[model samples]
Target: MSRKIAWIAAGGLAATLTACPARTPSLPNTPAPIHVPPGCEKNQTGEYHHAENPAFLYFGEDDGGTLTLGVARAREGLEGPGDAGTTVNIVLQRTPDGFVGETRSTTFTPSGTACPVRFPTEATACDDKGLTLRSVAATSIDENCRPAPTGPNPQWKEQRLVRGAPDAGASDAG
Candidate 1:
């Protein structure tokens, strides 16, 4: 009968629709691994020094400051179960002269493409008198230029402030 035919057609259409697989949304461009120059190695440590402001030194707790740099092992291509690569996060107070006070957190990734590690220079602070503080020197760790990871997690290695401005010299040497 017409009813039977209609039911059969509806069932066939429903079955066909269910048989098709769902499509997944395309993912955005993932960044490649950051490059690590010679002397820079995995788990290596260092400090982000202020050229002029000695108080604004980025080092570990043992270095007389609170801010400490941390790193984690990341799989190639930045794929991993936890924090990928060497992540560098800084926990310091923002000051008119530069980052002062306690260093809240910092991570450094020693591989892959360049990523922004932190706000190295500040116009108001470092650019004072037209002279930039400039990240004079850093320890021999792979400092990747990428955004720091977030969340209430723990797996980062604490970095100590080995040296700072007036002593730590100047250069982007991690």
Candidate 2:
């Protein structure tokens, strides 16, 4: 009887071990953050807001040798001829390095004027990740209904806009 009891107990232990599979390590609650390039910070990746201005910048996939970006502002309202909201399509051609490029801004005003803005000495940099873009209040109008950099360049000028949150994956505007 004792031997039979021992045998049954051993078999039950084996069965119990086999009945329950090994436990796996629990997964984390949130996914890991995205990756970013070195020396790069975040720019206008998604929705951006300051005190009085709201802006958006979208960087699309590279098409051939050109890069496309959608720049939009929805807060400023003009009286004569413009949408309360406006979007500027930006097309850029890269130089040798990935840092420098030529940008052409094309926008149609509310007055039905198609304007292309370019300068002889134009340079586009995503340097330091457009740290000052958030400071812009969108005071871009003078007496004339034109785009004006009324604020300081370093404080209000648009620069490299990224595609992720500033803390998570602040990457290049690819």
Candidate 3:
């Protein structure tokens, strides 16, 4: 009887060991390398090209009531226009913060007139006529700025504009 009991205990122990799950080896912690897109490096002037995403233009009436336009990004390292092909007139102003203020106006050389403009941030408001502008409030500015690694020759893309409905289209008559 004692021998049978010992055999049963040994079988139970073996079964328990078999039921246990295998352990996986732990991997060492290592930081991943940062990815910088094409044509996003800094220029000779020490300004980096703005990244494409999270980057957007801002337009509104300035304090003097004149039309105001600017482009902003959430991250640093953006200096000049990366890929936005439109020729823009830019002005830099001093700000209390270390960063400088930038304003831009598109040169509609082809049409000889300023084309209606829109930015990612102002898309909703300008949806009506396909033309909208937004104010540069403290909150709006704060939400758009992001930190990024500075680089030279940062690449930029041109923003394409869609024309409004053609005037020639007429309503159908039954």
Candidate 4:
């Protein structure tokens, strides 16, 4: 019957569509393994200082070689974020079971807010300057160039206070 033939054709098309290979092609739902930039030394324990700006943005392996990322702003130049300071920490612990990425943002002043937004990521985080920190590769290059190879995020005005090549120190070592 023509009805039977139509059903057979529909079934074949459905099977072919499900087997298509273009489902998803992207990085895993989490950040890649942390890679410490060259020329920077990891502290005996805790995060390594990758860049400095009165405060420090630290990233590297800790005492047990556990990869971690953190930012610290403190009074009296305290060494660790737990001191009289606050911090934002992102730790990636790999295990046989799975990968665990724990991120915590410390607020200097309690806003007494009743919460509005639910989910927030690094890209949504803003600093005291009200500017978001852009992502730079381990080599300090703007690999993705979200803003531009030489441009910063929120690309409205030119406001890169520290201007230089990412690997300026490595190149100047000679």
Candidate 5:
């Protein structure tokens, strides 16, 4: 019967379509690979110092493409007497411009006040020289003693940090 033939044709078309493999959709654009700079390479970890600002950046392990670090921005001459430095914790991802990431900074005031503040930070690796660190902070402090999220737009600050030498006065005993 023609009705049976029509059904058979439809069934055959369905079978053929299911038998064909589906094509995968390709990405329109692929991101370029990240460039790792010297002193920030895998397994290269240590403390770097910013002489002018009296800050310190301690680099942790560069495992799995992520770099964790601690930043200590000394406030010896920048803040009131008895004020310590500002410390920032950063987790940076490898980027085309070295490493970029967010930071949480805590400024220690002379009155023992400290609070977490969010900000953006960047770092660039150099050829056996040091790292160029760029960071931004709100100029004002909130009532809660935290760094305010207001100021000259970004207030970007930069510093060049070199490898710190071992302290001669430090004792080996724990």
Candidate 6:
């Protein structure tokens, strides 16, 4: 009787283990879809070339529907050693008319002095052809990293970017 009871208990334990398999770890929630305005429905994910310069802008969607624009400029070593080029990161949130956000710029000088500045920006008239972006802020920090009073004119001038091919280095699978 004791042996039969032991066998029965072992069989029940095996059945329970088989019935409830180990649960896999849960994945993170997916990001919510970005709500774009009527005219802004066109795909804006690509690389843009400056109208007159060799600079390029890469526009892509980040997590949570935020748009990230990366600015890459053509710099030659002739500028001298330790002369790091300027880096600009622009984050834009979708709005009714277009995208509104700020532009953060950091210029690295040969002397290793870093001047970081920010400006309020707006992007409008985004289409399959190009995008119009303007900096609405009037104040900008100077090279000495002091808040300099800008004149009536805006600090960062407006720029028009013409659409170009998507960057080949970026993975499309994502």
lDDT of each: 0.37, 0.42, 0.32, 0.36, 0.63, 0.65
lDDT at 120 for candidate 3? Answer: 23
Using lDDT as the measure, the top candidate is 6
Task: Mark the 10 consecutive residues where model 1 has the least summed lDDT.
Answer: 122-131
Q: Pick the TM-score winner.
A: 5
Which is superior by TM-score, 1 or 3? 3
lDDT of 4: 0.36
Query: Between 3 and 6, whose TM-score is larger?
Result: 6
What is the per-residue lDDT of model 2 for residues 10-112, given as tens digits with 9 covering 90 to 100? 9999999999999999987984443323332233233322222224434444444444555444323435423334444444444344323333454555666
True-vs-predicted CA distance for residue 70, candidate 5, Å:
2.5
The Cα RMSD in angstroms, rounded to one decimal, for candidate 1 relative to the true structure is 18.6
Query: Candidate 6 — worst ten consecutive residues by lDDT sum?
Result: 165-174
Q: Write the per-residue lDDT of candidate 6 for residues 1-174, one digit (tens) a residue.
A: 999999999999999999997999999997656455444556566677665453454555544345678876543344532224666778878755457788888754446678787788877667777777788545545557766566455657777777885444432221
Judging by TM-score, tell me the better candidate of 2 and 3: 2
Cα RMSD to native, each candidate? 18.6, 17.4, 20.1, 15.4, 7.2, 11.9
Q: Over the stretch 75-150, how does candidate 1's per-residue lDDT look in tens digits?
A: 2344563343335444433333344332122444556454343434211122111212223133222344433354
Candidate 4: C-alpha RMSD after superposition = 15.4
The residue pairs found clashing in candidate 4 are none
Q: Rank the candidates by TM-score, best first.
A: 5, 6, 2, 4, 3, 1
Model 1 residue 39 CA deviation in Å: 3.6
Question: Would you give me the overall lDDT of model 2?
Answer: 0.42
lDDT of 3 by residue, 88-126 (tens): 423322122211233233433233544422222211122
Superposition error at 105 for model 4 (Å): 1.0
Better of 1 and 6 by lDDT: 6
